[model samples]
Every structure is written in C-alpha cells, then in structure tokens.
Target chain A: MRNLTDTELAARVAQDIPDGSYVNLGIGKPTHVSGYVPEGREVIYHAENGIIGVGPTPAEGEEDLELIDASKRYVTPAPGAAYFEHADSFAMMRGGHIDIAVLGAYQVAQNGDIANWATLDNTFPPAVGGAMDLVVGVPTILVMMRHINRDGSPKLLRECTYPLTGLGVVSRVYTDLAVLDITPAGFKLVELTAGNTLDEVQALTEAKIHT
Target chain B: MDKRLPDLASAVAPITDGSVIMIGGFGSSGIPFGLIDALLEQGARGLTVISNNAGAQETGIAKLLKEGRLAKVVCSYPRSPGSIWFERRYEAGEIELEVVPQGTLAERIRAAGAGIGGFLTPTGYGTLLAEGKETRVIDGRGYVMESPLHADFALLRAENGDKWGNLNYHATARNFNPVMACAARHSIAEVRHLSDEPIDPERVVTPGIFVHSVVEYGVRP
Candidate 1:
C-alpha cells in the first residue's frame, strides 16, 4: 500500500476547499496546505494574530519583521488584507465568519472529538492556543494528520485518550492513507491513497470505517 | 495636552514593583522592547505580566523572567518553542502562571476596557482550563464565565504617534496594543515617530484619550 507524502496529503486537502473560502490553517502540517492551494482558487487565509487576508511566505531577504502568522513564521499580506486587534480576529473565528479551519490532530474519535493540544504526560506545559476557539467557531473543522502514531497505533479511535480540543467538532479528516468524514453513524471512508485497500486501511483505524 | 515624553526612562518610571502590567504583543510583533529594556534597568521586582507569550529567550519578557523579577504571568501560549526560560521557571515553581484561552484572554481585556463585568465563552468550557470557573448552558451549548482583566500599566509599541498620543500600528504589529491601551490605568506607547501635529483622526487606531504618555524611538530627521 502506498502512503501519501505530506505535500501530497496537503494537495488532497486543498482539493476539497472551495474557491473564495475564508480559511484558517492551523500551525504545523496544516500550514503547508496554503502553498498547495489549487491555481485560480482564491482562498483568503486568516491568521489568529489579526490578519485576515494572509498571503504566501515571502522569498528569502524579503521577509518583514512584523508581518507574521500565528506560527511566528513571516508571511506577506495578500491584496486587500485587513489588520485588526486580536479580539476582532477571534470574533471572526467565534462568530462563524470563517468558513473552514484546517488543523493538525493527535487523535480523532468516531464521534468527532479532536485531541491535539495536550498529551497525558507533562513533558511540556499544556498550551491550548487557538484550537478550541477554531474548533467551536469555524463552520467546518478539517483535521490533517497521519493515520497512526509513531508506535504504529491507530489514531482514528473509538475514544481519544488525550485531552480533547473540542467535542463533536471535526467534520472531516485528511490523513496520509485516506480521506475520511465524521458522519452521524461513524467514520465514513471517502477515498484511499493509491495502492491501498479498504481492509488495509481499516486495520489501521480502530473506528468502524463505512466504505 | 501633549503627552509625549522626552525619553524611555521617564515613560516607564511610573511603573514600580508589584505592578500588574500588560505588555502588548503576540510573540514579538508589537512588543515594546525599548520599554522592556527600561524596565530591566529600573530593576523592578514582583511584577505580574499579562501577555500572549512569555516573550522569546533572552529578550523581552524572557529576559525579565530569567532575572527572576516577574512574580506571575497571566497569558496563553506561554510555551513557545524558544520559551525555555518560562518552562524551567514554571516547572521549578519559581513563577506563577494563569493560562487563559487566547480568545478569552483578548475578550477579558476588551471587557475590561469596555467596562463589562464578564462574559460566557465556549472556548474552555470542557477543559482543565475551565476548572473552578462557573459554567452555564445556553441554547444547549456550554460556556464558562470569564471576568475582565485590568492592569495598572500597559506598555505598547506603535508605528507612529502625535504629541497628543494618537497612535497608528504597522500591519499585524497592532495585536493587543489598542485594547491594552484602554484596559490599563496608565498606557505608555513607544512609538517610531512622534509628530508635532496631531495624527489624521481617521488613521488613528488608538485615540489619544486612552494613552498617558508616548516615547519616540526611531524618529527620522
């Protein structure tokens, strides 16, 4: 079975985003989705740090010191970009002005609970940045992550062991192996990466996969 | 009246030990570095800082944290990758931390400025962050009660300011500065340019009424 690369997975996620959608790309792997947005599709990126129309990363030596995203990575402003205070930015999120929010996840339950901010161990102090707000506020929550943990354990589970970022908030998930939707019944398989079978993918997912 | 101060030291001189201060910025964008340096030189101790992150390592609030001057920090996302100073201090119990959801933090400050008592937010309703907070269900959704957050002093950075203290910010650097200016009793702005004439009223992101003093840093001839 073929496992999709990070970029490939990002491209797949990009395909699902409709044109002229206002989207927020969560930090980490989800940040890569902005670059793979299909041509001619004008997706307005929102950064929680008060930028609504976020543009692509600037070339070397062209980076501005102040124009940065929530990830602290420098970004350029898109045409017609608007900057406001943090309160206004989160208002856009919590007020349901954002059409979609793409985030990275540690685990996803069959009921659509997402656990991404903190783990069981206290290796690093639990920091819930803006995930909770995004999960609850954005109209659609799309998670981008790997199919399994480093220990080869399934990430699509009956219940998440870690702390949940939101309950029943995730609508769809894009992973390295396949695209799945969180339906009222359970996990519904949308499509698999090339060379992968339903049984193989199902073996890695603890939740019941409805093909 | 004109609120422009002569220099940074006098601008931050009113801040004494044990002051609850809000330093405007998200990470490093709108951080008042010059005022931070002045505060370090002032050597005030037992400060309660309110911000988004605990600054970066060896700079801004991190330097103050390393000096063991800050008694408490009320913020979200204090554990940035480079925030080792806060990590060691927090683990060792050297400093106190009150973590609020980022949106809740901003709204609390906004509430303080707007003179609102408190509001219900769904951000931390079901998490450990919501522990000990009052919870209410409205329309079948749970929300936690969050109170307003006020400060004794607010140190912020602005792109330009007039002698009247009207201010403008550069792009995303405007984060938290405007709201913080209103939430604090004394709002001090470190501005790149200080003009003799009042800034255009329409372009002023922070009106002069919210500011107490202004320190010009990068004024060009």
Candidate 2:
C-alpha cells in the first residue's frame, strides 16, 4: 500500500495552516513543517528559546552558534524577526497567543490525549520540554507520527499507555497512512493516502475510525 | 560602578556550597563554558544548578556533573543531543533531577526576575509534573500554580556588554541570560564583545542593573 513520506506528511500539515497564522514547531519532525508552507501564505514561527519568526536553516559553515532553534539546529532569522527573553516568549505560548503547535507523538488516544515525552523506562531520563505548555496553551494541536511503531503496534489508540503530555489537547493526527481528527465521538477520518482503504488502515489502528 | 571581572575564575569566586546557580543556555548556545570551567577549579561541592538542558558531550553542565559537585538540577530537558553525562549521573543516583515543562521552567525563572511570588499557568496542569502542585479551573481550563525559581548566582553568556554591565546577547544564545541575570542575587556575564563605552541604551537587551559582573571571553569558535 502507498504511504506518505515524512516530508509529504509535513507538507500535508503545512497545507492545513491558514495564512498569517502564528505556529510553533516541535523540535524534530515538526520543524520540517515550516519549510513546506504554501506560497503567499505567511506563517510566523515561534521558538521557545526566545525567538519569533524563526527562518530556514543556515547554509553549512555559516551557522551562528549562539543563534539556534529549539532543536539547536542553527537556523537563520526570518524577515521582521524579533527576540526576547524566556518570559515574553512563553507568554506568547501560555497566554494563548500562538495559533497552532505541530508536535511528534508516541501515542494519541480517541479523546485527543497525547504522549510524546516520557517513555517510562528507567534507562532514559524523562524530559518534558515545552510540549506540555504548547498543548495546554495553543488553541490547536497537530500531532505528526508514523501509523505504527517500529514493532508495528498501533500508535492510534483507545487510550494512550505512555504518560500523557497533555489531556485531550490533540486536534488532529497526521500519519503516513491517513489524516484523522480526534473528535468528541472518537477518531474521524479526514482523508487517506492514495491506494489506502479504510479497512486496511483501520486494521492497524487500535480504535475505530469514523469514516 | 564598574563590574568587570579580571578573570572567569574571579567571576565565580562568590559561589559556595549549596549555591543555586542558573547556567544560561539551551543546548550549547549561550552556555558560559569559561565560567563553568572556573567553577570546576573553584571546586564548590553540593551545588544545585538550573538550566534548560543538562549538558551535551563533555562541556557545559557535564563538567559540573563530572566533578560530582552538583547535588540537584532543576531543568526542563536534562538530556539533549549528546547529553550522556546527564544520563550516567541520573542513572547512578548521583544527581537529583527535577524536570519542569520547558515553558513553565522559563516562566518560573522569569517570575523570580520580575519579582512576582507565584503565578497560575495552564501548562503542566493535570500532568505528572503538576502532581503535587495546586491547580484551579479558570474559564473552564486547568491552571497550575508555580512558584518563582530564584538563584544565588547566575552564570551567563552574551554577544556584547559594557563596563556598566549592560548586555546584548548574540542571536538565540540570549535564551535565559537576561532573565537569569535578573533572578540571581549576583549574576556574572561572559561576553564575546566587551568595551568601556556604554552600548546604545535602546539596543541593550539586558540593562546594567540586572548584571552584577562582566568579562570579555573574546570571539567565537
């Protein structure tokens, strides 16, 4: 069956964002969403490290060590970019100023509960970065991840087993196989990748997807 | 009054055992490596360090954890890319780690600098991080009451600063330096650009009042 590549999925998420929207991208996969913004549609990027209007990656050998994104990936500033300390930066988030947040998740439940931070394993330290803040603060939350884990277990579930980053915060789930919305009634199918059937995708999902 | 320090070692001289120090940085950006090294030489034990990330590879907070001087760390993310030092110490029970949500951590430090006792925030509500904290529903949404996180000393890095302690941070490296400078009792700043004349007042991101001392660390790597 056909599936969307990571970039294509990011592109899909980018399409959903309205023009002039203020969006905050998570560290890894979600960062790619900024690069795929449609032409003529402007999106202001916010990095919790105290930057608004985060721009593209700087050319190699030109990285400003002091200047970086939340991922510390060494990014350039967009036009009209501004900087501030942590307080003002987070106020833009926790004060409900940001429009949307695109995050990577390990598990998402029918109630829109998200789990991305803690693995609950003793080997790795549990780190909860700005995810909690973004989920609770931002008006809309978008989760991007693969349809299933490496072991092939469903990430779309009736209830998330991992510790939640936020309770009932996720608005949409963009996976390789399909794009689904977490509604009051449960998972609602928005669309699917070409060559993917509802039965084929539903077999891999732990919860029932309302078509 | 002039607050320039002769050396990085002297900048950290006032810090002692049980000192709560805020190291300004996120990942490698804005980390005061020279001051962290000087603190290693100063050898104050049982310290509590606060920052966004613990350390990556062998530098930054890793140096302190390696010296076994730190008793605890209050941060949002203890492990960033190449943060093995934090992992080893955490697993061995050599360090106590208090992980706050990134924005909440920032706001708490900001609250200290801004002189507010405590504030209610929507972040961390109903999550494990808010387990023991007080919560209230405001306008049908849960908010957690977080207290200010003050520090005895704050180690910071900036792009430019003057003798009066006025500072201008380089790019994203400015992360927590400004707020940490305000929150600490005695804040020390290491700058890439240092001069005798004052920086343009309008251009100064952190005013002189917040910074206690300044040192010229010179250009970038």
lDDT of 1 by residue, B12-123 (tens): 8999999999999997888999999999998899999999999787989999999999999998888897998999898888888887788989999999999999999998
- Which pairs clash in the backbone of model 2? none
Worst 10 residues of 1 chain B by lDDT: B212-221
The all-Cα superposition gives candidate 1 an RMSD in Å to the true structure of 1.8
Docking class of 1: medium
Over the stretch A125-152, how does candidate 1's per-residue lDDT look in tens digits? 7677888889889979999999999999
Residue A162 of model 1 has an lDDT of 93
For candidate 2, lDDT tens digit of each residue in B59-143?
9799888879899999999978888888999999889999999888887888898899999988878778889898999889788
Interface RMSD of each: 2.9, 1.2
Question: Each candidate's TM vs. the true structure?
Answer: 0.96, 0.97
- Candidate 2 Cα errors over 4 Å, as ranges: none
